[model samples]
Target: MSRTIPFHFVDVFAVAPLTGNSLAVVDGGGELALELMQNIAREFNQSETTFVLPATRPDADWKLRSFTPKGVEVFGAGGHNTLGAWWWLAAAGRLELGDGPTRFHQQIGDLVYPLAIWQSQGKLEKIIMRQEAPVAGRQLSNLGALATALGLNAEEIAADVVPCQVVSTGAAHLLVPIRDRQAVDRISPDAKQLFDLLNEVGGEGCYVFSLDPLQPGTTAYARFFNPTVGISEDPATGTAAGPLAAHLVAHGLAQPGVIKVEQGTTLGRTSIIEVGVDAGSVSVSGRGIVVASGAFSI
Candidate 1:
């Protein structure tokens, strides 16, 4: 005899059902073994898959564990995977939400984080998640090697505007400033070389961005790559966007308010990530829609 587990495919940070970053949300995954979870993640083959589990600690309302297609366990409460899972839970009526803003605690790894959602007339509005305090580390100085890794000329890097450095809200990713949107679009990275560079810089992924955004009122046009975790390119990465917003503010490149980041244009799944940085703390918020839901047999 076999059993099936319910799952949902959500488009996080999306304007429509199919846009933004796709995530697989698995319900009642706490009973499954670790190896089985990895196999399920590989089977889905998305950038990330999230498992919603019952909370072991009293302080948390629920527990979330996200894994990459490569079986790498992602440990960030502010990631799209976590947000999409919560969205699915709320939309599926798995959790009871109030009419206004309701708060919930999510246990990711060893720490618990707070998340809020707004509801009006029994409809879910938006989800906001607070990330860890911003931390800066490991500035890269070798522009020529970095350029080679990204398949661009050394002169294309806008080092005068902001230094290429690692920033983290929860997951540390290297933030590189580019000359323009065209240059950002033209990047053809060598994955192996880029992964090596990221390893050297103590970074998990690379976020290349330009000040000139294609969309008005957007702070930056960006692209994300995390070869270490087998994500060739992500449509929208909240973990990276939060850090980029803080990095810009720390370097005096942008104001410390609501920073909108436009990404995934090159992939055709355009996404907008709203990040707010105030007094060295960061928060990321977005909305997601359920495009597909089914069951996984075991």
Candidate 2:
């Protein structure tokens, strides 16, 4: 017998239907095999595809597992994949959201984190998730090799602004500060070289950014690339954005508050991510648009 699975497409951090990072959410996926889930993720071919499963623990309301197009199971709760999953949950009438902020727990990997959904007169306004505290990891020592891998001159990498380092809010990723947004946009990473560097540093992805943002009031303009997981580029990445915000605050480049990072302009997606950092805690908040829904028979 064949199984018919329902799924929805959400544009995370989007103001419009086609903008932001696209995510495919598979509903009622508790019983789906892991290999089948990976296959479904590949079929969707989005930056990330999420599967909604029943909560395995009492402290959690639901369980979410996300997989990349390359079949890598993403465990971090700080990314757009998990955010979009909960957005669909509330929008689909699965969760009872009272007016104002409602707290819910989500289980991703071995941990359960609290997430908040803000509602005004029963309308879901935004979803905010508190990520793990920031951890400033290894600093990339080879700017020359990194510059060549990114197809830029060594001088383009602005080590003076902030040293190229690996930081984690939920997942570890390399943060490369460029001189300006122009050089940030000019990045053309050699997949093999970039992958090797990331592997050596134990980073999952690379986030190249600059202080000059296209939008006013935004702190940074950035792009995401993860050859390790086969994501060539991501329009919006909450996991990376959260870490970047915390990193800036650690460097005194940004104060503790809601810092907005503008991303996806180079890819024409254009996403604005609001990251809040206060007293060592980091959170990412955004609204997602449910663009489409359908059933997959397999």
Candidate 3:
């Protein structure tokens, strides 16, 4: 006989429904096998699917296992992945949220990330994650070659902006600043070359952005491509967003405050990822709206 398990469909980094990065949250999976988890994640074929099990550690409330569509288990504190699970839990009453600061520890593959979720009148006000200090990684000095790989000419490369560089909070993402919105939108990088280049630089993917944003008050409008990890373009990449925010602050492009980021426009799913940076760690926060929920039998 097949067992039925509860699952939730979530849209992270979007205020409205049906617009944001997608996450499939599987509830009550303490007994599920790793191979089964990979199959389930592949079945969902979302950017990432999470299996939430009872916490083994006393400090953690829940243990999360993240899997990409490539059928590989990922080890890290995924920003939207973590928030989306809790969002559904709070919405479904699995987690009791009081009108105060609630500290929760999320265990992912033996790694724990401290998260603070604020609630007001039983509504989630903010979700903040304390990430590791930003680490400056390999820098790409070849602007012309980079521009060509990103489907742009050398002339379109923004000379006034900072050079292409890699930054990591949890994951390393190459940050490339373009001249304007038009240039950013015009980017259609060669998939094979981008994947190879990112691998060459020890980066998971590349985040190409433009300071001139379509939305007001946004620090930048960006797009993340990671064909190497099986993600063509991410709607809202919280992991990379943190590094990007840190890069901006370190390079004197943005102040150490709440910086807004708009992403996923090209895919029709507009995502807003808020990043907070100060003298230490970076906090990436966003709202995850429950789009659908049901049970899966396997």
Candidate 4:
């Protein structure tokens, strides 16, 4: 007989509900098959969905797996999904108030995440993780063909910075720095052209960014497109935000510390993502609110 498993859906990186990236979480995923997990992730239709499995090591906290809607297993860490999973575990009473730090053994490697829970004015709040510093990769291409793929004119591209470069902390993305926020908002890339350019750049996807240093801590504005990976436009992307922060510091565009990223504005869903970079590794963290909780039979 099939048994229904409990799950929780959350909006990450938002202080309130409905403002950040959404993720679905299955709390106990020790026995689910990889194919079944992929199918469930596809049915959820989110940019990323997570399954919490049993940890082999007695000292380890949990074993987590992340999957995209396209059924591809993700390497490295995900910001919103991590936060969403923590929120679910804490709310369900599986984790205590002073659980200290939690270790997640992911596809990339083992990640240690510290938990912080506070009660202020009778409202409960939690911040589960800090991301590692970003790792910079080689510059790949210029703005010529990339501009064509992104539906932008050559003149509209940024000359000071090159386009179609690879950047990563744990996951790699082709970084495409645009000229302005307006150009970023108007982007509608041709799928075939985008796929070809991504292959040429040796990246799985592309991240489009523009400087929006007007905000006190915010250094840039960005939107990620990965039609090749089954996501047209990501509302808030934590994986991309890590490398974007590194790019800003490496290029001297922003200070080498904590920075804020604003995304999904053009898509009508605004999200604020925070990134902390120390030395070389980067850590991306944010708030997540539980939107719904239920169960499904496999």
RMSD of each: 0.8, 0.7, 1.3, 2.8
Worst 10 residues of 4 by lDDT: 100-109
Q: Write the per-residue lDDT of candidate 2 for residues 1-298, one digit (tens) a residue.
A: 9989999999999868899999999998888899999999999999999999999999999999999988999987768999999999999999998999999999998789999999999899999999999999899989999999999999999998898999999899999999999999999999999999999898999999999899999999999999999999999999999999999999999999999999898998999999999999999999999999999899
Q: lDDT of each structure?
A: 0.94, 0.94, 0.85, 0.74
lDDT of 3 at 13: 94
lDDT of 3 by residue, 187-234 (tens): 999889888788878888899988988877898999998887787788
Error of 1 at 165 (Å): 0.2
TM-score of each: 0.99, 0.99, 0.96, 0.88
RMSD of 3: 1.3
Q: Where is model 2 more than 4 Å wrong at Cα?
A: none
What would the per-residue lDDT of candidate 1 be over residues 85-152, giving only the tens digit for each residue?
99999999988899998999999987899999889999999999999999999999999999999999
Candidate 4 displacement at residue 117 in angstroms = 6.2
Candidate 3 similarity to native, TM-score: 0.96
Question: How far out, in Å, is residue 293 in model 3?
Answer: 0.6
List residue ranges in candidate 3 displaced over 4 A.
none
